[model samples]
Each structure stands twice: as C-alpha cells, then as structure tokens.
Target: MVIEWLTLMVPADWHERFIAADTAIWTHFLAQQPGYVGKQIWRNPAKPDELTLLIHWQSRQQWKAIAPTALAAVEQEFRQNLGRSFDIIAANEYQPLADGSISSQRPMAD
Candidate 1:
C-alpha cells in the first residue's frame, strides 16, 4: 500500500467548515478514482490550525496515475466550496517496508 500524507493549515474557527467541504469534495472525488483505498483526517490539540490527511492507495503508480487536469478541477471545486484556499504545510508519500511488520499476522493493538 502507498500512503499520501498531507499537512494543511486551516484556521481553528474554520475546522468544521474545512472538514465538511473536504469530505464532500476531495474525499468523494478520491473514492471514485482507481486505487483509492481510504482516507483519514486528523488534528492535534496543540496545533489547532493544522490538519493532517492520510490517503491510502493500492500502489504508488495508481496514485500518481490521476491526471493533472482532473486533479486541478477537483482542487478548484474544493476551493470554491470552501470559499478560501488552504496552505499545505507539508506533503509526502510512503510505502510499506519489505519487512513483514505491517502485513504480518501480529495485531498492531491488543
């Protein structure tokens, strides 16, 4: 699996609005795309303005296969829905190591 990590800055007061619009726009659009597995949104109490998004994909190729034009359109829709632009603090991609830690039978939590 490939994981897309994005850290964004959205004012605390706009957290709810951001989540609502993101779920309605980006999440929905991603779900319809090939290789999309799932996504999660997270926040830290100490960093109320920061939002972290974890997007899972079946493979790096599949994730990168999304056309630039399609991505631009979705981003435009997202901005329009939120009525503002968000700052992306960081973005990164990760893939599971060859070691079987992730895929092993051992549970991550008891």
Candidate 2:
C-alpha cells in the first residue's frame, strides 16, 4: 500500500474553505476511484494554520494516475478560483514500510 501525505500550511482565516474544497475532492475520489482505499484529514493541534492529508491507495501507479488530474483541479480550480481562502505551503508522499508503517512502527490510529 502507498500513502500520499500532503502537509499544507494554510491561512488561519480560510480553514473552513479549505475543508470545503477538500471535502468536495474527497467525495469525487470516493465516487470515481476504485483504487482509493481511504483518506484522513488532520490539523495541527498547536498550529491552527497547518493541515495534513493522508491518502491511501492500492498502489503507486493508481495514485500517480489520478494525482495529476486531481492536483490540477485543485490548483486551477480550487487555488485559482479561491485564492482568498488560503495559501498552500507544501506537499509530500511516502510508501508504507513492511510493517505498514510510514513514520513510526506503530499503526496509525483510527
């Protein structure tokens, strides 16, 4: 399994808007993608402006296939259409270890 971790630093005032945008995309993925297993969205406990997205896929290829189109929509539609909402800081990706762990040996909590 592969996990795509997207850590975004968003503007504080636009949190709701960001969530709305993400929710839309999440719904889209759930409906159209068979390879998408699940996803989790997180926010920094300390920093209100930080958000983290964990997307699980069946394989890297499945993820890569949908990534470009989804990302382009997020960039062109969400970002451009709603620049007043927030500023995206960064995004990253990772593969699970043999033990099904990415950052730690322990399993991620539900």
Q: Any residue pairs clashing in model 1, and if so which?
A: none
Number of the top-ranking candidate, with TM-score as the measure: 1
- Note the Cα lDDT for every prediction shown: 0.93, 0.72
lDDT by residue (tens digit), candidate 1, 10-87: 899999999999999999999999999999999988999999999999999999999999999999999998888999
TM-score of 1: 0.88
Instruction: Mark the 10 consecutive residues where model 1 has the least summed lDDT.
Output: 99-108
Q: Estimate each model's TM-score.
A: 0.88, 0.69
Per-residue CA lDDT of model 2 for 40-100, tens digit only, reads 8788979887888888888888777766776666566666546644445667777866673
lDDT at 89, model 2: 69
Model 1 lDDT, residue 105, Cα: 60
- Give the C-alpha miss distance for residue 76 in model 1, angstroms: 0.5
TM-score of 2: 0.69
